[model samples]
Target: MYTKLKDELLVEAYEHAVRSQLDGEFLQILKEELDRRGIIFDEAKKVATADNNKS
Candidate 1:
């Protein structure tokens, strides 16, 4: 349950970061944080796209 929540939050943060156009050191920091949490932003994006397609 906790893992699921964490994953959701990470995805949300990733989406926000992308929308915010974060770059350089700030973007690197976000990537490192996600990596530390074992979250792959690309996979999350793919999953999100697939889900949207399904709908």
Candidate 2:
């Protein structure tokens, strides 16, 4: 749940950042953070699937 919330916030922040025309460095940071969060979400899903299989 927290991850999902964070993802939503990141999306909003990204859009805002784009609209407001933030510096290149800040935009890159947000993009990298979003990408990292996506990897975390994918790993969580894989773990959940493996746990489900054990049951």
Candidate 3:
């Protein structure tokens, strides 16, 4: 189902998923698809996570 989304949509969805803290198998599918498509999150979430953890 997720494989049909455009690159931009997929990236947005993945970012939202990460920000929303959505997990389980649903998020896994997004992660797998992103990797399969060679699409990365650009470390936006990575920086966020690091900042969040510093508190």
Candidate 4:
């Protein structure tokens, strides 16, 4: 349950960052932080796709 919540929050943060037009070193730092937390963008994409498919 905690893992699921973490993943959801990570996805939300990624979405917010992208929408805010973050780039360069800041974006890289964000990616690195997420990676360190075991949340890669590709995995997030897959999770999002799966969620969409369920609807």
Which candidate comes out best when scored by TM-score?
Answer: 3
What would the TM-scores of all predictions be?
0.47, 0.57, 0.60, 0.45
Candidate 3 root-mean-square deviation in Å:
9.9
Full ranking by TM-score? 3, 2, 1, 4
Give the range where candidate 3 is weakest over 10 consecutive residues by summed lDDT: 44-53
Clashing pairs in 3: none
lDDT of 1 by residue, 1-55 (tens): 3554455676676678888988767767766766666654454364233334457
Clashing pairs in 4: none
Better of 3 and 4 by lDDT: 3
Superposed model 4: Cα runs more than 4 Å off: 1-7, 41-55
What is candidate 3's lDDT per residue for 1-55, written digit by digit as tens?
Answer: 4657776687778778988999767789988877777664444532222334469
- Report the lDDT tens digits of candidate 2 across residue range 1-55: 3545455577678769999999989999988976765523343333122334469
- lDDT of each prediction vs. the true structure? 0.62, 0.65, 0.69, 0.63
Candidate 3 deviant stretches above 4 angstroms? 1-3, 43-55
Better of 1 and 3 by lDDT: 3
On a 0 to 1 TM-score scale, where does candidate 1 land against the true structure? 0.47
Candidate 4 C-alpha lDDT tens digits along 1-55: 3544466676677778888988767767767766665654464365343334558
In lDDT terms, which candidate is top? Answer: 3
